[model samples]
Target chain A: MLSCKEAAALVSESLDRKLPLGQRIALRMHLLFCRFCRRFSRQVLFLRGTADRVRGEKEGEEPPVSDSLSAEAKEKIEQALKTHSESKSKP
Target chain B: MSIIDPSKGKGETLNPENWGKDYADYLFRYALVRLRDRQGAEDVVQETFLAALKGKDQFKGLSSERTWLVGILKHKMMDYFRKPSRELPVSGLITSEDPPEEFFDLNGKWQVKPSSWGDSPMDALEKKEFWKTFEACMSVLPGRLAQIFALREFEGLKNEEICNLFNVSTTNLNVMLFRSRMRLARCLETNWFGKKAKGE
Candidate 1:
């Protein structure tokens, strides 16, 4: 009998790869009786769904958070580019 | 957009001088979301620009400059994550105490059973406000967990690829992924779904 801990681990693994038939059956049996684990299995799927959506959005569409790279960092990057380009241009 | 005659090359130009002003934020945001480290993100974005400059001659203009730069940035970010120096910290992830213990008891039963989150997880996902909560959850995730999660889910790397990159066994990799998903699921439930359930 797989414990909830073991069951939940298998649930997560199911998302990453195919599970062996034996372990899959054990997990299904365990989830059959455990409402918490069932909710957990569903929520784990939910997490995956949410994660994919979060990454699927087009880049530069404006992050919900207003944070940006600091001005000093931007200045520093520009300086590095300027130095490199100048060095390349020289003999 | 003007139609280009294929015989006459498009001659898309590279203005390396204005790249910082034009694309720095775009690249930084992409890196920051995946790397989740301001310093690391800055370093990669800087590295990307420098590499682009060094290889500017290779810019055949098949793609837009911004597209070319982002392609370089993606490679840079992968290197940043896979660097040998980072192994010291990432190794710590392998040795951390089992996370399932936090949720399960000595008998391996759930300490706190997961509560009903109500219907339509998709509904919450579609809400603009949910992203704020999701970002907050991601920001608070332990650094190693966040990195693995980003590589797996955000970058959509295959499990075998990540296993090779991190040099962990399949079981170990699954454990890491499990822990991260559990943490993220719990965080979203507590912060978003659980709140909605209670009408708070």
Candidate 2:
């Protein structure tokens, strides 16, 4: 039987790649009796969802985004762009 | 002046005047969450616009203006990661410490079973505070690990692409990803779920 540590590693690895059939079978067997590993798997999925939301992936369903650039930052960018355009227009 | 002329392209022209109004906030937020540095994020957003302006003629209407700009911004982010000074010392992120005893016993059996999070995780997704807490946890991660995690999870880059970007072997990348997820899970469990459990 795979230990919880090994099983948890496999669970995380599964997220990034296709697990080999042997390892997949081992993980499934381990998860059958391990509540903690099961929870860990769920948590990994939740983390993925949270990260996706951060990237604005769940656009329509997610709540309004709370963070944004401050007015000062916007002004700075505008200033920089103004300089860039002026330089482009120059001889 | 109307900088973007419809006669020149199928998509609406990208007006320089409206660049900040149209994309600054969105781009800033995206960079802020990934880079976890307001000043750095601001600089990146600014550079993205400047670069966009230089290449405005190449805008072929293949994608939305926002998507094109974001592509530029993503390249800037990858550049930021590639800089030597920005690279964190990744040696001790995962292997240095002993595994937590609660998760496994000496014989490697699970000593503490993971408790159900109930519906709280899903519910928390709708709350602004959840993202705040999430960002806070993400910010505390080691820089390289956080960058890799964001590239994989948030940017949806493939494993081979990520390996090429970081110039690391696949085994190294997978190990870093596993450690990054474990760290974030533990962080949310303590900072978000634990606080919610106490009604805090």
Model 2, range B1-200, lDDT digits (tens) per residue? 44554566775558887899888988887887777678888989999999999999898876667878889999998887677776546664444243445557887776655667777578888888877788778888877778789889988889999888767778777777877887888888888898788888
Clashing pairs in 2: none
Give each model's whole-structure lDDT: 0.84, 0.81
Superposed model 1: Cα runs more than 4 Å off: A63-65, A89-91, B1-14, B60-64, B89-91, B94-99
**DockQ for each model:** 0.68, 0.59
In model 2, where do residues sit more than 4 Å from their true spots?
Answer: A56-73, B1-8, B90-105, B110-113
Candidate 1: lDDT over CA atoms?
0.84
Q: Give the TM-score of candidate 1.
A: 0.87
- How well does candidate 2 match the true structure, expressed as C-alpha RMSD? 3.9
lDDT of 2 at A29: 97
Clashes of 2: 0
Kindly list the per-residue Cα lDDT of model 2 for residues A6-86, writing each as its tens digit. Answer: 899789889988999999999999989888899999999998887767666533233234578889999999999889988
For residue B99, give model 2's deviation from the true position in Å. Answer: 6.4
